[model samples]
Target: MPRFAANLSMLYNEHDFLDRFAAAARDGFKAVEYLFPYAWGAADIARRLADHGLQQVLFNAPPGNWDAGERGIACLPGREAEFRAGFSQALEYAQALGCPRIHVMAGLAPAGADRAMLQKTYESNLAWAADLAAKSGRDVLIEPINTRDIPGFFLNRQDDAHGVITRVGSTNLKVQMDLYHCQIVEGDVAMKIRKWLPTGQVGHIQIAGVPMRHEPDLGELNYAYLFDVIDEVSTQSGWTGWIGCEYRPSRAAQPGATSSGLGWLAQRLQ
Candidate 1:
């Protein structure tokens, strides 16, 4: 298997999220992810994992004003204070949860903001967090979420993530090239993965589909062919890591996601 992890946040309406996590482990998921784990104490979640022997793959740091469609806040001007306070909390949450990767979201920037200033702020804060995250042996990564799903959101392209990763200049900081978002923002998903794979700083990977942003196979992207490309990369030296099935389920309890993704992911790992 490719080392799959469940995104607990997306299953909000279906059942108790933590319980769902426990069930995932029982169903044989070795890894998992969460969008926001703030409401649940890390100790409790950690205990649940212990009860099942599951590893948490990654979790998104809290996005400010989530209901307001503010996807993130890392690059905003005059919001450094909020970012500092909020990010501190997020890091603490990650630490307690023993999560290795934190996905930094670049929320919407203020109106009429200076582009140069925003970029500077993004780079500085990322570098600063690199030091802080080092304390926990954790990675701080910026993700390029698609603007189609999150209208007016900042950091909507892989280029933006790539530029910031280059600027931060830290082994602990990198791009979260979401295959789903990349498919929308730009095609050639597997090819880009090959190109960026060498950086070793593309800390994490995620996927859904192109237009619908639903299940991975339900969209135009050919996951079967994509999986083969990834398998090739795995064999090459210096580029291999986890690729999350960060897509929403087409239906409740799709075992194929767990079973099927694992079947293909196992090849990629080899």
Candidate 2:
């Protein structure tokens, strides 16, 4: 069976950020993930996790000046120092929270920029992150985000993600595969899952309804069938990882809207 982790960042918006942990636990989620945990102290978040008995599965390293619209700085050349400092802070939180994986966003590409130079910088940064994280038995992840959702994102294809992982040459480095983005950027998500899961390089997976970014059952992709595919592939490959429920609630204004939209998850659990 595929383990599901509620993405607290997107779900349970009716509650305060710290309160979302209890909401997810009330919904029977054993694990949780989010965009970032910087706003709250690690000890505070850790207390919530312990109280709720939910494990922290994944979260992003700080993206530079999110208010100013920077997605990430890993692929940018001049921001290496900033990226290192931010990622180091992320590691401290991961250690405190006992989270195994961290996703490092590949920042947007500059217009008419040198693609080769950008890639070199990206690989160098990732290699360093992997090496640093490996000492602590933690994995560093790179994700291929869709251009439609995040235009000019430096990483946007599975092959490109794997290529970078290969060149970086670190076992601690892995890809965070978001099927929603995969469907938008390239069709045939099942085939991609089959091909990549067995490689042992895919560290985590995320899902949402395509086009709308709503519940898994709301859009084009048939998640039930995909879940079965994941089960089958996982059974054969010995791949055990959490599938993050990263989506927006269709009914945003209603109290318990997030929990009410969880019928798909309930059906699957049966």
lDDT per residue (tens digit) for residues 1-270 in model 2: 899999999999999999999999999999999999999999999999999999999999999999999999999999999999999999999999999999999999999999999998999999999999999999999999999999899999999999999988899899999999999999899999999999989999999998899999998999999999999999999999999999999998998999999999999888
TM-score, every prediction: 0.89, 0.99
Q: After superposing candidate 2, which stretches have Cα over 4 Å from the reference?
A: none
| Residue 266 alpha-carbon offset, candidate 1, angstroms | 10
- Per-candidate Cα RMSD to the true structure, in Å, reads 3.0, 0.6
Q: Per-residue lDDT tens digits of candidate 1, residues 1-270?
A: 244566666532255777877666654567778788888888998888778888776887777888867777788777788877777888887877778888878877677888789888878878887878888889888888766777766787777688777777787887877888888888888888788877676777777766766656677998778766766776673455566666665555654443443343454445
Task: State each model's CA lDDT, in order.
Answer: 0.73, 0.96
Best by lDDT: 2
| Candidate 1, pairs of clashing residues | 1-265, 1-266, 2-265, 72-107, 73-107
